[model samples]
Target: MALVFKSLRCPHCQQPIDKPLLKQHGLLQAFLKRKPFPCPHCQEQAVLPEKYETLISIGILTAVILAPLLLVWEVSFVDSKLLFGLGAALAIAGLITQKLDKA
Candidate 1:
């Protein structure tokens, strides 16, 4: 399983808002900086869509599931290059799936 990031929306106006891809943007960065973005239409606070936390959990689970397999393969008879390449491929695929999944 991989994390699914749902696109956010303004709660009051129901306008679709772009979810931050990295921690640098959105409320996820509030710990470092709190920038208030007023809803363009309703003049209220904009919020991210629900289920983002679940997505994070899913992504973490995906990593946990993959890590041991990667480690085991590295220690086994599998070629190092093959093992590393496969691990990279799996990680990239997981990230792509999470990014591309529709809300």
Candidate 2:
């Protein structure tokens, strides 16, 4: 529930970068590989922190683990679907709000 809003910034320009720009530049792959990516604003290299990556990984794992457990609990179909949808939304929110650091 600590999924507060955050913005990715360019190290050189110190300007906020959009999520779409990061996706366009393959920054998500660069995060897993611990590689630097060019900032769309200033073209300076930046990298997502290991902590951020780990947090996102954990969020995704939680959603994956919770899916089958929900079914096994025999909750009403509508309730289970609602819970799963909430979980998935949280995972994606965590991903978007995590910040990137200078390379």
Candidate 3:
């Protein structure tokens, strides 16, 4: 579950970071943050979610996220090879999101 990606921080308030900054510069210093990013819709800190219910963390979330794809081809048709593609996509997305939260 370790991540090597980076996230962005606001230049004015050092709050809600973006994707471009991280992808461009790789890493940024926390002390350089100068702005706070408030969500225009909710007026809340644009932060990431780290909280997870134990039940969901223990596989429920996995089922929830992947259920859609499984249902798409739920019929008795495809071979076991398809699972690898789905698993890879899910793993990459999860890794990116995890790194985003920390940045």
Candidate 4:
């Protein structure tokens, strides 16, 4: 199983945010519920686009699939890094597809 990532964007300013940033701000609730998440760039509230919801589901699936592999498989460090990188790339791609919406 491969790792997958989910990306987030600020709808107001259209700025991309990584997982760490979102976690720091406790914005996952907004994303999960399609509620408004504040945009640091524009100081406005924004919500995740409907189209990008699948990305979040995919990210969860990937995590479920890859977590056990990481624990039980004899994967090398480089392989693990590459897997994680792929996950990050998926997340970034999902984020890039996001569009801003005024809430």
Best TM-score goes to which candidate?
2
Model 2 C-alpha lDDT per residue in residues 10-79, reported as the tens digit of each score? 7678888765666777665664465787887788888766665556666666567666577788766546
Worst 10 residues of 4 by lDDT: 1-10
Report the lDDT tens digits of candidate 1 across residue range 19-97.
3432334344431132454544455654333243344445454455555665666656545555445555655554444
Task: List candidate 3 segments past 4 Å from native.
Answer: 1-76, 99-103
Clash number by candidate, in order: 1, 0, 8, 2
Residue-level lDDT of model 4, residues 1-103, one tens digit each, is 1122444556556688655676687876665566777776666887655655466456544545674477468766636545655666665666566564678
Candidate 3 yields a Cα-based lDDT of 0.40
Model 2 Cα displacement at 89 (Å)? Answer: 8.2
Q: State every prediction's TM-score relative to the real structure.
A: 0.34, 0.46, 0.28, 0.44
Note the residue pairs that clash in candidate 3: 8-17, 11-34, 12-34, 12-35, 13-34, 13-35, 13-36, 14-35
RMSD of 2: 6.7
Error of 3 at 87 (Å): 0.8
Residue-wise C-alpha lDDT for candidate 3, range 1-103, written one tens digit per residue: 2122454343335554544543344322321242233432233443334332222243334444455455666745643345445455555565544422322
Report residue 51 deviation for candidate 3 (angstroms). Answer: 7.6
Per-model CA lDDT versus the true structure: 0.45, 0.66, 0.40, 0.60
Q: Candidate 2: where are CA atoms >4 Å away? A: 1-7, 16-32, 70-93
For model 3, the run of ten residues with the poorest summed lDDT: 27-36
Pairs that collide, model 1: 3-59
Q: Order the numbered candidates by lDDT, best leading.
A: 2, 4, 1, 3
> CA lDDT of 67 in candidate 2?
63
